[model samples]
Target chain A: MHFNNEELGQLEDRYRAKLINSLSGFKSANLIGTTDGKGNHNLAIVSSVFHIGANPPLVGMIMRPHTVTRDTLENILELGEYTINQVNADIWKQSHQTSARYEQLVSEFTEAGLTPEWLDGVKAPFVAESRLKYSLLLRESQTLEINGTVLVIGEINNVLVEDDVIANDGYIDIEALETVAVSGLDSYHVTNRLGRLSYAKPDKKPDVID
Target chain B: MHFNNEELGQLEDRYRAKLINSLSGFKSANLIGTTDGKGNHNLAIVSSVFHIGANPPLVGMIMRPHTVTRDTLENILELGEYTINQVNADIWKQSHQTSARYEQLVSEFTEAGLTPEWLDGVKAPFVAESRLKYSLLLRESQTLEINGTVLVIGEINNVLVEDDVIANDGYIDIEALETVAVSGLDSYHVTNRLGRLSYAKPDKKPDVID
Candidate 1:
């Protein structure tokens, strides 16, 4: 099937939204954890998290413009800190529930029956249930004029993970962590390792690690 | 284990890179196809692709700084068009091979053994083996001064997918398409659908869709 811009634009609003959303395929599923000055914590399931760079350990996420009240974005901008917690199979249901529009006073962690724990002195709370979690300090943000969406970039400030999940080479075995990948807005998935290959080289045929 | 900023900054370079890279969990793996004015096609596998918005149907990808001469980025900037093809389990090895630093004259499709099929007067070619592919017209480009990485944003111009893979609501069943997700830099993963939940509501308990 082929859908040109004309056909895509003609799709019903919700239909087109889903088509465009899921068309990109599986994305990293993480719960963005934030807290306001008053210690009001917010959690939202997001699929847009991607690596910006590794030297400063930066990650980037996208937020839709005025689509809904983005408490997570507001909190991050206010405090300049937030946490990214990988959603695993065990906590995916509760994680997805965080997407619900709750009153400003209500914390998604409390409403969804998930535990939020503060790491060291970090103001933002981390999902205690998540096996792999990291804290990031706001570094830069840019608004895309083409659309109302804002691109938020952050630098990793702290990280907490189970010791076994980290490979000697520094690769975290996400499958070992049982972290979920999301499609569109609602689907949750578990991934199986399909084999990790060696660094590609022009003359060498890539070798797959067992 | 807790890793603070000082600790993370002190780790071995390669180890830190892998740790930070894989921390985000599974990322959408796609082969970006582009062609220069001279009509030479280029393909490079990328995992930074993320949705910016669905209205104009924009997608954003991140390219590292001074990273080994990015031909795909150059081709898109030069011609203002490109295609994103999902990398599935069947072609993941070939897809990973595309990451090799090939000479500018070497086409990844030819070197990696994937077929590039030009579609409907579109300047860029689509991967013949990919079940889901889309062509995009450049909409915006911005360089993140924080890290010198470029954020390339494009609007969806054309999309092609297998017929049965799309659900009634417009969500593409990526698992049905056998799309593989990438972790860190070299790991490929196959995902299994856990469940698709309904839109969360403040009052209503979300239900799992059949």
Candidate 2:
């Protein structure tokens, strides 16, 4: 559509789109489980998870502004421990619903009808339904300037994956998890595999992808 | 599923995807169109496009570590101009096919069976089919350590869009464009409007979304 620069900016206000996706597409985790030092467990859906570094196996997520009221942010800051649970289509509705403004003490797990299973030593609980869950420890936290969001970097201290879902190599068969991507908001999408582009190996022919 | 450190690291090779998505998922762009420096155009897809800053609107793209050889890379470096095309489900197949390594200098438009239109002053062409296209000028190139790929950031000097798409606020209604998003590799996705999040306006409920 033809729009002058001025016209487009107005849409930002009329539309109320958060532009939270400024990061990248394909959000990995629907729920981030965190806790406070007092052991209060809080759950929230985090769609901004991104890989930061591989050497240390670091992953990061952009926690929306003022999520400080939640426990996940508290746990990471106070206990430096948390877990990421991949959300699949089966529970995406409940997962997205967790975003509703609930009291700080309200347990989203109970609110969403999800089972929170605690790992042996980990403080936070894992989404029992999640095929893949990572028990991570806080690595670093940075506040981004453009927006008032905290970039939580975590070290993969321990990982829990359903057998047969993970290929021997790191390639995860997300298809097995049936995890979907988050669109603007309140929308969930089931992702189907379209075939992978061959790794740009030194001598391989570049294949046409579907 | 329960796995220890040794086992998880073992599967890292395949299961651990790389962090090529520098797209904070926030202020990123979908490649909206592509054209030859001389004016012929081709429509392709990209989600890794990001902005370095606004003073000049510097944008960059992280070519996948798979398929798609250095042609587009060379083309941009040589001609110094290329249009980034956005993909909607309407042409998701054609846009998805551009990931292929076609004959060198073969117009992806012809291969994908799409058309390209030229801009008046720029060397590269824009995808005439795109709801939005930004004509960018090369700015700076930086090589990322992990992937060995150089991220080319450009300044958006001009843009092309169908007349009706723009609003008065200077923000483009991308949802109106029905843009498609890329997941790990081959998946083409249609996004549904959720609610938009905000940076400064944390108090207001996210009632409006694209």
Candidate 3:
């Protein structure tokens, strides 16, 4: 099938959303955990998280304008802190539940039946069911001019994970943790390893590292 | 195990890169195809692609600062057009090879042994082997102040995909097309879908859609 710009724009609203969302291929399934600073906790499943840099350990995610996600954006800006929890197969249903529009005072942790745990120095709560998670400090927030979506960049303040998941060279074996990937809006998937390739070099084809 | 910011900063650079990159979980594996408008085509495998919005069909990807990706960035800025091809298992090795730093005039398509084909009215070349691909017109480019990385936003000009892969509700069955996902910088993966859940509502638990 071929769809040009005008043809794509003519697609039905929800249909276009699913078609365009899946065009990015597989996405990271994470739950952004934040609080209003007065005990009201918020958790929303987001597939937009992407790695920004390694030296400063930055992470970036997109927040859609005029949605339930506004709570998450506001909390991060107000408190300068948030937690990103990887949604595994075990807790994906609960994580998806967090997307429902709940009142500002209602905590998604309770509504979704997930426990909120606190780290030693982090202000935001972490999903106890999430085996791989981290705390982030808000670094920057910018609204794209073409669209109202907000780009939220954060610095990784700390990482929490199991020791067994880390390989010798610091590659986290996410498949071992069963970290899921999201496609479209609601589909969840678990990945199988296809072997790691060596660093690309101009003179040779990449070799399987293992 | 937990690593605070200070400890994370002190780790070896390459090790930190692997760790930090993997923290974002599974990412979309895409081959960004661009040209200098003088027939010098460039192809680079990127895992940073993420969906920005649906109304305008916007897609965003990050370009690392001072890297081989400079070729891809320069080409997009000059021509205002590029193609995003979903990397599948059959051509993943070839796609990874595009990361190698080649001379300004060297075409990665020739080096990696993949064929580039162009569609009507789109200047950017598309991977002939890519079952699901799309052409994008550059809409915005912003250099992130926190990091020197550039965020490239583009509007979807056209999409080319197999008809069978699209479902009734407009969800593209990428698993059927065998589009792969990336972990860390080198590992590739194929996914097994768990299930698609229904949209969340405050009154009830989400149901399995299929």
Candidate 4:
């Protein structure tokens, strides 16, 4: 099936959204944890987290239009700090529940039956059940005028992880952590390692590592 | 374990890069296909594709600093179009090979053992071995001065998919298509659907859809 621009535009609005959303395939699943000035916690499931740079340890997330009233965006902007917790199979349901549109005063942590724990000095809370998590200090944010969306980039401040999850090479063992992958808007997935290939070289075939 | 910002900065370079890369979890795996004005083909494996908006069907990809000389970025900018093909189990090894540094005039499609197919009126070619592919028209390019990276936004102009891969509600069945997910730089993954939940609501629990 081939859908050209005209045909794609003709698709029913909802259907086109679904098709486009899932077209990119599996996305990172993380719960963005934040707290308002009064220390009320908020958690939202985000799939757009992508590495921006390694030296500065920066990560970027795309927030939808500001017209949507995003609490996570608000908290990150106001508090200048937050935490990103990898969502694993053990708590995917609770993580998904965080997407619900509760009132301004409500905390998704409490509403979704997930516990929030703060690092001694970090302002934001981490999802207590998450095995791998990191607190981030807001670095820079730029609103994309083309679509009215904001790209929030954050600098890593602290990382908290279970001892066994980190490999000797610094590769986080995500499969072993059971961190879920997401597709479309509502689907969650569990991933099995197919293989890890050696760094590519022009003259040599890649060797798959154990 | 907790690694503060200062400690993260002091870690070994490769270790820090790997740790920061894996922090984001699974990313969308695709072969970015492009054609130069001279009709030369290019394919490169990319994991940065992320959904930006569905109204105009926009997708964004982060291109490393152009100082490194990226062929896909060059071709997309010169030709004004490109294709994104979902990487799957059948071609994961070939796809990973696309990451190797070939000569300036080399076609990774041939070097990586993948077939390139053309669609009418689309300048760029899609990966013939891929079950899901989409071509896009260059809409915008913005350089992030903070890190010297470029964010390339494209409007999805056309999509070619396997007949049965699209569901009734317009969701692309990535699992059925065998689309693979990627972690860090070289790890490949096969996914199993855990489940899909209903649209979230504040007062009601999300009903898990079978």
Candidate 5:
């Protein structure tokens, strides 16, 4: 099938959303946990998280315009802290439930039946069910001029991971933790490893790394 | 295991890259195809692509600083057009090979042994072997101040997908197309889907859709 810009723009609203969302291919399933500085906690499932850089250990996630409820973004702005919890197979359903539009005072941790654990120095809460998670300090937030979406960049403050998942060379075996991937808007998937390839060099084809 | 910011900063550079990259969870594997508007074509595998919005069908990708050979970013800026091809099992090795720092003027397509296919009205070439792909026109480019990385935003110009892979509701069954996901920096994966869940509502738990 071929869809030009006009054809794509003519698609029904929800249909276009699903098609365009899935067009980006598989996405990381993660819950962004934040607190309003008081006691209200917020958790929202986001697939927009992407690694920005490694030296400063930066990460970026896209948030829809604040035209509607944007508790997670607002909390991060208010406190400059948030937690990104990997949504594993065991907690994918609960993580998805966090997307519901609960009132500002209502905590998604309670509404979604997930436990929120607070670590020392980090103001935000982490999902206790998540095997891999990290705390981040807000570094920058910029709104794209073309669209109203906000780009939230954060620097990693700390990382908490299950011991067994880390390989000797520092690669986290996410498949071992059953970290799920999201496709489209609501479909969840568990990944099967297809061997790691050696670093590419122009002189030779990459071989499978042991 | 827990790693605070200081400890994380002290780790070896390559190890930290692997750890920090993996921290974002699973990433989509896509080949960015671009041309310098001359004869030189460039292809590179990128896992940083993320959906920005649906109404305008915007997609964002992070490009590392131009300290090294950044043919993809340069070509996009020069021509304002590019193609994103979903990396599949059949061509993942070839896609990975494109990351090698091939000198300017050498086409990765020729080096990696994949065919570059052009369609009507789209200047960039799509991977002939890729079952799903799309063309994009550069909409905006911004250099992130926190990190030297550049955020490249593009508007979808067109999409080409395998006919059978799209469902009635506009969800593209990427698993059916054998689309692969990347982990850390080198590992590739194929996914096994859990059922799609219905949209969340505050009143009730979400049920599996279809």
Candidate 6:
């Protein structure tokens, strides 16, 4: 529809909830600690994590702005690292709560009622419950002033998916992931894997025009 | 299905092909450009725009490494201003092709056979073909070293939707907008308005729960 700034002010929050609850139907994830450096350790549930490119294996994420202090922003700026920890339905609520304002000393893992683990070299924490925790290094971070959010780009250094999550050739099963997407705020959803379209190899014949 | 990095490495190209080619239906968009200083004119297509937050209305995009000189990045770095032009199915191809490495002096609108417009006080050129466009300012820019990509973040300042495409309360109809989407490489798709959802208001249920 249409909205003036004052009317559309809730756009981000609305979209966030829609994305999490409606569009995303497979899994949720947590924004963990910094990667290569010791910046900050923060936690929040994000339904947005999709690749932008494959040659370089690039991934994109939407980091909503902080109403208060943003630990993830501070940490990533200082340490230059982050881990995207895949969240199943079980930990979605707990992970989502990490959005709460907490002191630097407080760990979201404790507050979220979850455990934060570590990989040998990466600085970002891993959700102990995750079957696939990607230890990615922050290659770039940008803030879009229009939306008052931060888009963090990460180069994957290590993918710590449990053996069970993959097929022989790296195919990931949506069912196994059991990931949920957030639609509106607390609403959650799971989607059917509509057969994947073969984008790389165009599959249709050119239609004849009259 | 599951895949290991090693396996993903072998089939990465194939999956990429499928992934990109599969983008036959989705919301396609263009990133209008402006100088960070005095608002130099720039226009480029962007399928990478993504939200990073709700409260701040943050969004981000992955810019291919500077191998190709991009005025948009320059503007974002220099003046920190940009606009996202949402492309419909009608102009999706033209918008997508703006990624071709063209001369810095060459106007993409001219090269691609499109018109560039301006709005608000921003100097960036907008795609006349877009159904909706949002003017924004660069809040931050982070270069991703791991993937050799740059992430640009922008906050939305003003949004412009073609009168016909918007609903009364700020709903932008995708089906009506005829928005398209993109994938890995050469892929294009028009999106359908699957449904709508509302944000979490604490006092109310999300609009999309049904």
Best by lDDT: 3
Clashing pairs in 4: none
Ordering by DockQ: 3, 5, 1, 4, 2, 6
lDDT for each residue of candidate 3 in B23-63, tens digit (9 for 90 to 100): 99999999999999888999999999999999999999999
Error in Å for residue A168 of model 1: 0.9
* CAPRI accuracy category, model 4: high
Question: Compared with the real two-chain complex, what DockQ does model 3 have?
Answer: 0.90
Q: Write the per-residue lDDT of candidate 4 for residues B64-138, one digit (tens) a residue.
A: 855323888999999999999999999999999998888879888888899999898999999999999999999
Q: What does candidate 5's lDDT look like per residue over B1-210, in tens digits? A: 999989998999999999999999999999999888878898899999999999899999999857333878888998999999999999989999998888888899999999999999899989999999999999999888887889999999899999898888899999999999999999999999988999898889989894
Q: State the lDDT of candidate 4 residue by residue for A1-210, as single tens digits.
A: 989899999999989988999988799999999989796778999988988888888899999744323988999999999999999999998888888878878999998999999888899999999998999999888888778889999999899888787878888888899989999878899998999999888898798984
Q: In model 2, which regions exceed 4 Å deviation?
A: A12-29, A53-55, A67-71, A167-170, A200-210, B12-15, B18-84, B88-183, B186-210
Error of 5 at B101 (Å): 1.4
Error of 6 at A50 (Å): 4.1
Q: Residues B1-210, candidate 1, lDDT per residue (tens digit)?
A: 889999998999999989999988899999999988696888989989998788889999998646643888889899999999999999999988898899887898899999999887699999999999999999888789998999999999999999798889988888888999889878998988899999888887788993
Candidate number that wins on TM-score, 1 or 6: 1
iRMS per model, in Å, is: 0.8, 6.5, 0.6, 0.8, 0.6, 7.9
Docking class of 3: high
lDDT of 1 at B78: 91
Docking class of 2: incorrect
Q: Estimate each model's TM-score.
A: 0.98, 0.65, 0.99, 0.98, 0.98, 0.56
Clash pairs (backbone) in predicted model 5 = none
lDDT of 1 by residue, A1-210 (tens): 999889988999888888899877789999999999896889988889999889989999998656444888889889999999999999988988898889987999998889998877788999999999999999987777888788899999999999888888999898999999998868889988889999899877789974
* lDDT at B89, model 1: 90
Q: Which runs in model 4 stand beyond 4 Å of their true positions?
A: A66-69, B66-69
lDDT (Cα, tens digit) per residue for candidate 2, span B185-209: 4444444443333321223333333
Q: Could you tell me which residue pairs clash in candidate 3?
A: none
Clashing pairs in 1: none
lDDT per residue for candidate 6 within A1-210, as digits (tens), equals 233345446555655333212211111334464432433356655655666556555566666556433666677667776777765656555655665666666666677677778767666787888665676666777665555566666756666655564443334443346544333234343333322222221123222111
lDDT (10s digit) by residue, model 2, range A1-210: 332234434444434242212212234445788766565667788766654444456656666556543556766788888888877767766676567667777777777678888878887788888766777777667554434456566767667766675444344556546766654334445544434444332224335443
